[model samples]
Target chain A: MARPASMRRSRRVGEALIERSMLGCALLSVVTTAAILAILVRQTGEFFAEVPISAFLFDTQWTPLFADKHFGIWPLLAGTFLTSAIAIAVALPFGLLAAIYLGEFATPRIRGVLKPTLELLAGVPTIVYGYFALVTLTPVLQKFMPELSGFNALAPGIVMGVMIIPMITSLGEDAISAVPGSVREGAYALGAGKLATVFRVVLPTALSGIAAAVVLAVSRAVGETMIVAIAAGQQPRLTLNPQVPVETMTAYIVQVGMGDTPTGTLEYRTIFVVGATLFAITFAANLLSQRWARRFRER
Target chain B: MQTTVDSDACLSPPYRTMEPAQMSNPGVAAKLSVQELSAWHGEKQVLVRVSLDLPEHEISAVIGPSGCGKSTLIRCLNRMHELVPGATHRGSIQLDGEDIYASGVDPVLIRRRVGMVFQKPNPFPTMSIRDNVLAGLRLTGMRPGDLDAVVESALQQAALWSEVKDRLREPGTSLSGGQQQRLCIARALAVEPEVLLLDEPCSALDPIATTRIEDLLGTLRERYTIVIVTHNMQQAARVSQQTAFLLQGELVEFTETDALFTKPKDKRTEDYVTGKFG
Candidate 1:
């Protein structure tokens, strides 16, 4: 009943070919990631050979494109953190509340309609969000605060917060739903109402997943280009004020990337250094979040 | 002489009711009285018109085959059955003469008065052992004056205090399966519930753990009116003073455990007890 020798050899060859093709697909992503890291490191190294590392880290101004060049990364760093902080402040409460409502309290019929509608916010193009911040949100805010700038960090920060709400809501809901029903039953048997059970038992159990979601969303906000560039003006200043113009690391990269600066010049190379710094921050945040999630699971 | 006869008739009813309360130990008042209770999950009926009286400060066991709706019966006791989507029930369950399912009665309060321990151990994985013990009180928003004393008393009652006292801050899931089940028991007891319901609590445990919990339940019977649903006939005989035998969602017999095991009146009960058919 065994197959012929020729047929057996052909099947083995076909299986080996399939295995090799799958291996190739798997290695493709690794190769692409390594390549990106290599280019960033190489260019960043070349940029640093010309500009002093201390000046890049400590100097106050970041006007490399202007006549007076100061390449301190502090201004960009400050602007990035300020906007990200504001975004997290807005997103944390709204996203978490929405997730809790969807996961714990909402009826299945309501969740069916509401969850898709919420996620549609993520599908809207980033350029549309940027324009909305610049034209609609900024003018409305200026009506209240007459001194508000035409292009300011507040509008973009708020818009970015709205843009990332779906990410947090989706992830948080999954985490909350993953908690076993028995735990909730135990809580209910103890006379805990819906809200009490959510806050006391469900929230704490889902904390690790929620933390990972927030970190990933923050990473997305840090790398976001259009909203910040269109609304947060290219005025790199080391200030925490949101009413005035600011330039984030991402926004500066967009500015220099589109400009007519010579590719070999120091001004042009500044983007790679800033990009590396941003990458490092986000990479660390992602690593920390993953570790936290793993530790919670192990426990 | 006629008036004295009427008064005697009125007084004799109490003594008459006490006669059938227990064959061996009479006069123990009923803590929970379920009368003509029927339940359904979605469209499928689970429990038929069932009537039983659980004695106060004693252990009662419900024994049935799988899918015979014994779990549903106990869940109906504290109104936990209605929590499931599309689950419905008729008739009334009275806890100390108060109908738990009456209009304007909150199921939440009923559950607090009648706490439950499930078959599988489910300690809040996020909370510490100390916190798990106090979860019933803290989650219900009552901050007791001395949290440590409550934890100590609850753990002691569950017979888990000596093993877990040194590591109160450890997560509740860090313990072994039996200890975690005991923690769940402690969690249920910490709220000082009047009635404690257990649904096949030792189905997932080893014999040694089962023996420990049975011994613990023997001690718990002095304070809490307890009802346990068990599939094992020996477990029901060993741990319960009163035993109710159920088949196909119908109550066949309820009497003293010794009588139910040794001399079941109903033929089906005899078959089940004698292992002729489950």
Candidate 2:
């Protein structure tokens, strides 16, 4: 069974070349991440030289464009948190229920038809959702409440929640489906009804995957740009009221990026500072999700 | 009742309806009976006109080679067969003289009365050992005032209490394969079923674990009518009081375990038991 010496040598050399190419592909991603970290830290240091960290973090106002500027980040942070919280509140219950229905109860014919249609929602561009929020949803809200502003957080937040619904539903369905059939049969043999099995056994078993899905959806909502920029106004008011207009972290970056601020100015550099803050928040969210998911992971 | 002339005409009314007095001369009550039962997986028929009577509070074993429909027969006892897609069945399965498949009977109630343990150990991975035992009660919404006593006694019945009592709060998956299987048994016993069905329960266990589970079954037989499916001929001889041999979904022979092993009335049964052919 021994191979010839020359053929074996050539095969060994080919394997080494393929192994090195794969290693290079893997290092590319690591190097990209390191480069992004370096650039953000360098620009963030430059931003802090002119503006103190305390003022940037603790100040209530975010009026970097005004003649007398107040460089606080609270208003934008508040807007980001508020919109994301609202989106989660809307998405979690409906998305999870849909997933349970699809995974546990749907007939094969219905599931074949419904699953792809639900996933098609994820394929639609966010810009279309932004247009829908501004033109259609805003009017509907104003009719219900006369105090509703033309460009308000409520419309954009609701639209953003709609956009992420398919993400949670698809991922949650996969998690539920991954539960072992033996465990489910055990539940059934113990006289558990359909609802009991779904709620107690299947949902709990899939909790880690569902938690991972929710965290990923929250990260998506936090970094969403077009929906907030178009539907939610450019005003960065530190108000909890959904009826009023507010600007999010992503919206502010887009706002500054489209403006005529000169290169190297503090006003121009504000985008990177805001970008770093958003990146930190999303990174923390991702870490928290992985930790949460690991706790309930199936052995 | 007279035996019918054409054996394939097994589903006729008189043949299907056997009087309780006509069974064995020892006269034990029949807890469950399957008469002229036939099953199909989709369009393919897998079982044909199989019939047997299971005595109360005793272990009866069904032995057969692979693809012989042993598991399917047990599934039909608890109406688990109907859960499969496109599966259909003919004939009646009676529990205490009531046809379980008759109009207006709920399969859920039948399952509660007849609990099953699968070949593989499947404890609820997300649940603590204590919570796994309480799952049946929690799911059925029949919580007793003193939950600790119920959990302790169920685990004690399954012979897993001493090894697990100190760490009942740990996840069920933390235990060894044998302990996990016993936990599953304890969970099934928590509901207090009238009949317990085990489908090759010891197939996944070591010899020691298998012996422990078999010993527990000896004790459990005093209270519950038990039916087991086993591929191991020695296991059937050791544990079952009566044995039913099946071949290609037909009931080839049904008799006392000793008689069937020592003096098989049919050549097919003799061939199977002696390892001549499946």
Candidate 3:
């Protein structure tokens, strides 16, 4: 066999091969995320020039409210935040407890059934759920609060909350499960009971991952469209009252898109502006989760 | 209850029969007696019928080759063996004049009185150093007023107080390998148990750290009964008054340290002592 001409040259060749493999995966991940961002920015920028970014982000009246220069975004922004908050409030206890049940308390047979069923919930189409919320859920909820309209923020928010339950439960369960069994055993060996072990030992260890899961689900909730469009009224009111009609940023985009508005016109351009803002908000949430997760990674 | 029978015949060694020390201080009492003990995990029996006695306030060393069930036997003392789904034991062991496995006795209480140190240093990761020491106290349900002294004494006993006193609130894992092991020892001692069972306490430590732990073990023998499981013949020879040699789950011999190391009674023990095989 022919030997290498020089040891130094051969070592450089080996190092280059290893470096290429290491950076290849990193490059792929960075490039993919960058491409998606670039596409959103390019398309959204074109939409913004016609509408004028100021009118789109900070106007008081959102109409098509008045037809000429009534470009308020507060209504949609408020609606999105309100719905997401409500969803978090509902999901925090229900989804987290469900995750706890599955991760800690459930027997194998029960866990086998529950996890996939939660997954099935995640797989259900938002449009179909939208129709269900508008027809079945709205009327049922209206009976409890007679003042509630046929299409209201509460119904859409509740549906959105239901939509995200699996996101919270599944990711939270994974975080809880990632806790090393030795940590749990240490607590158990100390004579701590199951609940004490879970709450005091397991939960603290898993908190960062769970927090990341919650932020990600909130991002998903903020970016939801079809269900909110179908069930939430397109009033674009800056109100926190759940029973009242409100329009989310996503819902308004769909409302504008579906109508006969001219494609490159100022009114039409507002949709992309809304889309860019939605994109920014979700990106911010994603970054926050990533930072929190990295900060808490085991040393 | 004790005698000096130059034990080269019973111990695995570089057997050095050191100058004689006083026999049976008579201060330490025999706390546990093991009889016809056998253990199995699933269908595979891991330990043969093994028997030995552990006296209070003295260190008893159990040594053997890997997989000889040294760890399983210690775990049996406090009922940790039952924690494994398929593990089962057949035998009788008495702690403090009471049968630990007898009906009506609580393993929880037995564990509190007979604490353990793991092979690797596992200080509870989530707790502060002070909190880690007090974990056993909290497990047994202690009021805050009662914890301060217990935590202080336990750390002092483990020889970790001087190193960690300034940073009591720091996580237990922030400590180095030897420090973590000593912290774990402090945690076990926090409950003020009568007996401490160490399963290879020094196995994960470096030579200097091993020497520190060995010194701590000798000092600790003045107050608490310690049953140590070790692979190091020098460590057992240096620290243990009574040494039991286990070969393939069987206790081949148990005798005074000097006698066992110098004049082994069994041929297998002699062979092991002479480094034919561990």
**lDDT, candidates in the order shown:** 0.88, 0.88, 0.82
Q: Which one wins on lDDT?
A: 1
A best-first ranking of the candidates according to their TM-score comes to 2, 1, 3
TM-score per prediction, in order, is 0.92, 0.94, 0.86
Q: If both were scored by TM-score, which would come out higher, candidate 1 or candidate 3?
A: 1
Clashing pairs in 1: none
What lDDT does model 2 reach? 0.88
Docking class of 3: acceptable
Docking class of 2: medium
Query: Against the true structure, whose TM-score is highest?
Result: 2
Candidate DockQ scores, in order: 0.63, 0.76, 0.37
Most DockQ-accurate candidate: 2
TM-score of chain A of each: 0.96, 0.96, 0.85
Which residue segments of model 2 deviate by more than 4 Å? A292-297, B1-26
lDDT of 3 at A176: 86
